[model samples]
Target: LFSAVVAPFLLASIPMLQPDLQRATLNALLQISAQLPVNQTSAGISVTYPPEDAWLTSRWPLVINMLWSLALVIGLVTAVFAMLVKRWLLAFQQKRDNTLPDDVDGFREQSVGLRKWGVNLIVGLLPLCLHFAIAVFLIGLIPFTWHVSKALGVLVSTLVSVGVFLYGLAALLGHMVVSCPYTAP
Candidate 1:
């Protein structure tokens, strides 16, 4: 269910995970310091310079793409894990027509053991993958926001930091508290 909701978002983000070639070209062209004024007047013309292009030249794109790639892989792995577990459970639930004398207790124990392992593994890892993917996406988003707007970048970075911090706190609490209901990987 969670994968159904998140898969679309992860897939949709594929096109946006690329570096901006136009921006990169413009940054390259703007590297020259020497330039003539576009307009001249007897009173002297004023020229405005754009903000530093360091962000474009830096490795932010590579870092962002790498993070997105990791998130995508994690999402795919989680989806596959979910499907495998579901199939296994369904197989276990299927009726068997064996008429030979069988030990009910042994069959029950085997079934229960397999079911417990599958359920525990899925429960423990699904949320962990989701949280990790979100964190990676948010981390990648900081550089993207920075490219769009510095104020927005700051806002996003702060919010993401807070979110990650809270997630870490929750995980720690879950580990420390025996009665905690939250699942942690």
Candidate 2:
């Protein structure tokens, strides 16, 4: 269920990897900068490339790529984790039946019994993990919006910030209120 919710977000961010719009903008800037008059020192050496070009061609793309890569990794890992948890639960349920042999019952006892491990804790934390993956994807999306329009970028950044803050506050409150079911991931 959590993986299903995160799939759309993950899919939405996949196109950011290409970032054609941003590349075109940077290419245009580079062309303009190339046309600008060159700067020469008394030593007779010409410096044609602007410092901004170095940043646009290198650092800006690096930041965007790194963020997207991280988000992708987090989303994939969380999805795999959810699958593992589902499999574990299913295996436990199948092994729970009395039709299994005595030896198999001993195996189940060692592995899947209610008191043998922190299965309950793992189940409780799945939602929190899902939220974390989604947050990462949202955060990585900011630069893409910025590339489109500064105002849109600001709007998205503000909204994402507020949403993250609210999630944190809720998690903190859940911890503080003993009766609350939500706890830290």
Candidate 3:
């Protein structure tokens, strides 16, 4: 029973972690770059690439690839979640319609339920709002930190934002489902 209640919250944290992970990767790459050697030639500057077998092994490129992978994962998961939620909502609405009697009282009852759902929806939106605020703060932090640290902060911030968004969305959908209108003949 405890697990059931906590499970959703835990799952919701995944999106929040996304930003942190991204920042960490970015910071790591920047830190690696800071160690690289650069020289000025007569025509231009030359920088020796790290050997293929080096531990840093194309750090920036690798980080870039990882970032792309993360983006793809986020997109795919969001799409799947949206599709499932849409189907579930449609099914729920249909069920409500079938259960309700075609009368004024039924309409009134459904309206009341809708009002309650609306309240829940608003409450659910709080997390999303908080997420946005945090993101804004993180953006502000970018200029204050060293290049590598700024990247890390950005990654952390992004994860937190995504987590909050996912959690808020799921909570809103759950509330809507539970508070959906149904009436008796």
lDDT of 2 by residue, 67-141 (tens): 555656666676777788799878766766544565776665747565567877777776666666666667656
Q: How many pairs collide in each candidate, listed in order?
A: 0, 0, 15
**Candidate closest to the true structure, highest lDDT:** 1
Error of 1 at 58 (Å): 1.5
- lDDT tens digits, residues 1-185, model 1? 54454455446545454566776667565544235444564443444445645765577766776777777778778878878877866765553323224767656765687866768677567768877876776777787788878999999989988977777787898998999875456
> Which rank order by lDDT, best down to worst?
1, 2, 3
Error (Å) of candidate 3 at residue 66 is: 1.0
For candidate 3, give the lDDT of residue 175.
67
Using Cα atoms with residue i matched to residue i, what is each candidate's TM-score against the true structure?
0.62, 0.59, 0.30
Model 2 residue runs over 4 Å out of place are: 1-55, 99-125, 179-184
- Flag the better candidate by lDDT, 2 or 3: 2
Cand. 2 TM to true fold: 0.59
Give the Cα-based TM-score of candidate 1 against the true structure.
0.62
lDDT of 3 by residue, 94-168 (tens): 756876476667656655775666644644453444444334433433322223376776776677668657766
The alpha-carbon deviation from the true structure for residue 32 of candidate 1, after best TM-score superposition, in angstroms, is 14
Q: Distance (Å) between predicted and true CA of 46, model 3?
A: 22
